[model samples]
Target: MDAIILQVLNGLDKGGAYALIALGLTLVFGTLGVVNFAHGALFMLGAFCAVTFKKIITLEQIVLSKTELSPWGTPLEIRTPYAQQWFGDFGNVLIEYSVPFSLLLAIPVMLFIGIAMERGIIKHFYKRPHAEQILVTFGLAIVLQEIVKAFFGANPNPQPIPQIFMGAADLGVMVGMAENVITYPKWRLVYLFFSLGVIAAVFAFLRFTTFGLVVRAGMSDRETVSMLGINIDKRFTIMFGIAAVVAGLAGVMYTPILPPDYTLGMDFLVLSFIVVVVGGMGSLPGAVLAGFMLGVVQSLASMTEVKDIIPGIDQIIIYLIAVIILLVRPRGLLGKRGVMEN
Candidate 1:
């Protein structure tokens, strides 16, 4: 029972990532009708944002110590992070919580990048062939990847979770189980809740706001919405930005779990795309649903009992299910009729 609960929590953690990335992909495709292969790069960029923030705050000042000397050396060097020196306890707190604090930097940066990408490049491909869209966006993704490599190098940079979030929580006690039976990382739990909050916020934005109403209307009938004297194109572009923000924030939060690297985006890109397809090409709810379902299945498949029964089941389970889902539901689990028909 404890094992089952642990795996479920793990599944939810993984699902949070999958849902965020897939949600952004679905948003772009639904609103713009453009296949964006470079969306994963936004996620990579967000992780880098956290990395950059940590680096900036931890910039060190080196000075020769007058009172201390190294063996066979004239003076010992002392180094202190600028943040700690400048802010004292507050700066120390900032450094300790750099990961969450990075959101401030990531949000605006991602928003700008998303808007610029859409306005500068994606808008031109709105009416182009899907193949062309894929090729061009893939090329753009490679370009972004190379640029990141040039700056940050190929090595993965680890980001530390806040001290407060460090260590595992005994969830078993809360659930009326034996003490310490179901321990889970506090950070992972925080991530799960954070992802849920973001997903809910996006849904609320689209369902409750006037802009969301028009966007939903545009998604249904683009020409009619335009004919009604609405600038659907502009709104769609903003939606693209919002999608980028979602992907970026996901990447940012994920840094503590998976170290930031240039290839980080590429690694998750394929899985997320599979998620979008299985969920339904443009269905937001379906994406979230499929993400969590697949995550749980994959987690359960990794168990020793399951792996013993089926060799390497964990690695192939997700792909196998994708194939099965496609075969059974041509338009995906929640895909609307006539979507992607053109």
Candidate 2:
């Protein structure tokens, strides 16, 4: 029972990430009517932001003082692989100092990349067919992934958890468990709560704010909204930007859990699409619910007993459930009656 509960908790954390990514994907598809195959790449870009930030902050030169010991206790001086591989001697300087500090410089730069993608590439595809959009976006995704590889290499680089979150918290006492039991990493807990808060804020924004109202209206009928003197196109662009930021932030925090790599986006992209479909196309609330549910199911499917009963259960459970759901509720749990009627 305790193990089950623990798995449930873990699943919730995974679900949170899926929910965020799927939310963004659904938003773009539901509102813009564009099948954004490059969405996964945007998520990857977000993780890269953290990597970039860490790299930037650690880029300072380490000049050993005449009479002082280095942080390593000796007159320590060594070149980092980054310098040796790329800049030659420059990367060595950064290893001597903090890397996470680079985040201050990495975020805005990433946001600019997001905007540039929207304006330079995605902007022209608004009126194209779904197949064309998907093909082009998929190509764009490949291009982006390759570019990242060109700069950072194809390796899954580790991004260390912040110093403040270096250890696990004792959740046993809080949850009435035995000693030496029920512990979780502080960084993961923080990320879980942070994700929840962001999800709530997004929902609140869409539910209560005028901008959200406009966005929602635009989603339902851009032509009608445009008739009312609102610039739906610009708003759509902003929405795209918002979606990028959401995916990016998801990627950012996720880096500590799963190392950031150019290929990491591919790992989540297919599952995110499944999540969106299971959640019901265009239903944000459904996406959140389905994400967490599938997360649990996927986690449970990994159990020894379950896997023994059904080999490869971990790989098939989510899709199997999705198939059942589709058979039962073709439109999805919370999908509108005529969402795809138009």
How far is 160's C-alpha from truth in model 1 (Å)?
0.6
Model 1 residue 166 CA deviation in Å: 0.5
lDDT of 2 by residue, 137-241 (tens): 889988989999999998987887766677988788797878757777877787788678778988898889999999999988889999999998887777777
Mark the regions of model 2 whose C-alpha exceeds 4 Å error after superposition.
64-107
Which parts of model 1 are misplaced by more than 4 Å? Answer: 71-74
- Per-residue lDDT for 281 in model 1? 95
Write out the backbone clash pairs for model 1.
none
**Poorest stretch of ten by lDDT in candidate 1:** 333-342
Q: lDDT score of model 1?
A: 0.92
Compute the lDDT of residue 31 as modeled in candidate 1: 96
Candidate 1, residue 38: CA error in Å? 0.8
List TM-scores for all candidates, in order: 0.97, 0.87
